[model samples]
Target: MDYIDRAEATRRILAAKERAGLSFEELAQVVGAHEVWVASALLGQNTMSSEQAAAAGKALALDEATVAALSRDAARGSLPAAVPTDPLIYRFHEIVQVYGTTLKAVIEEKFGSGIMSAIDFSMDIDRVDDPRGDRVKVTLNGKFLPYRTW
Candidate 1:
């Protein structure tokens, strides 16, 4: 098996959609992505983001876990993992991921500087009570330094 087989995830997604009696355009429309994006991912020419995969799961009537598995496989080049030898740079990397664009947007809008200093950042997670349900509250603070110009 190729260590990174892009085709497998794409192929599986396409196959799953087909087996479920849906068309490419239909799936793409349901998932709120362009048809071209769906086609490219199905052809193994593109990668699907978690947001996209989650939406796709709803469109395809698939469990979130299966969609997540496909995304994970696609990231790894489609080979089966054995014990996940890769070290986690972020302690929560195995469970939580950095949503790059979302974080970047918030950072740019708030601090108007460069990224959060991973070295100088702090994270706090706590449970909060809500009328609807319990919610996990997280707060992050980091020193801000403007980007240096050459």
Candidate 2:
């Protein structure tokens, strides 16, 4: 089947999602994947399996072209600018800018010269009840890959 571009596919999926009034979590349940992974696949940052694509298509009532697009390998990293313009995204960038070194130092101290593997990562977002206020909790879990030496 001829597939549409990832951006167009994303647009179509988003439109269908809005029409269906489905949250990413709901769609993820239908797709049998984590919400973040499903969302990333729908947004063109990651590829979905054929089964997942079909499930997501059914959930969102998406077209064949969009469904096919979802299974294609993605180019990844769609940030349009060096600094993100979106407030929420920018805040994440800000956090990295501020705490990147600290995190690196801590991680290195704990795990030696290694880096977390985004390729083998899973993330979860949840709400934590707090007396002061409800807090957004994001957990990122990834395998640690120590740098190889010649």
Candidate 3:
């Protein structure tokens, strides 16, 4: 599908999800995948398998085109700007900006010169209760890929 088509399909999927009163976690159960991955697939960041697409489509009451779009290869990271303007999204960008070098240094100290693999990554988000306030816990797990010697 074209960019506009994909955007519209995403809107339909989100609307149908809201209309059905289903959480991404619930939809993940129906699609038999992780909630984050399912959410990413639905938002056009990742491609879903035909079976997953069908399951999600059935659960969300999505049309054929939207379902098909879900299974298509996505042009990921379709952000409008390099720095996200949305507050929540911007927080993540801010975090990376602040901690990018520190993380790299620390990780290299432990794992040697290498980078984390986004292709082989998994993430989990949780709510942690605290006396002061609830805390958001985000876990990012990725394989460590060491730089190869030429």
Give the TM-scores of the predictions, in the order they appear.
0.38, 0.95, 0.94
For residue 124, give model 3's deviation from the true position in Å: 0.2
lDDT of each: 0.62, 0.92, 0.91
Best by lDDT: 2
Rank by TM-score, descending?
2, 3, 1
Candidate 3 local lDDT, 8-105, one digit each (tens): 77899999999999999999999999999999999888889999999999999987889998988876776876789999999999998999999999
RMSD of 3: 1.9
lDDT of 2: 0.92
* Candidate 1 lDDT, 28-112, residue by residue in tens: 7876766655655555545578877787767776554456644553332322444344564333344434566777778789878
State candidate 3's TM-score. 0.94
Pairs that collide, model 1: 4-77, 5-77
RMSD per prediction, one decimal? Answer: 16.7, 1.1, 1.9
The model with the greatest TM-score is 2
Among all windows of 10 consecutive residues in model 3, the one with the lowest summed lDDT is: 1-10
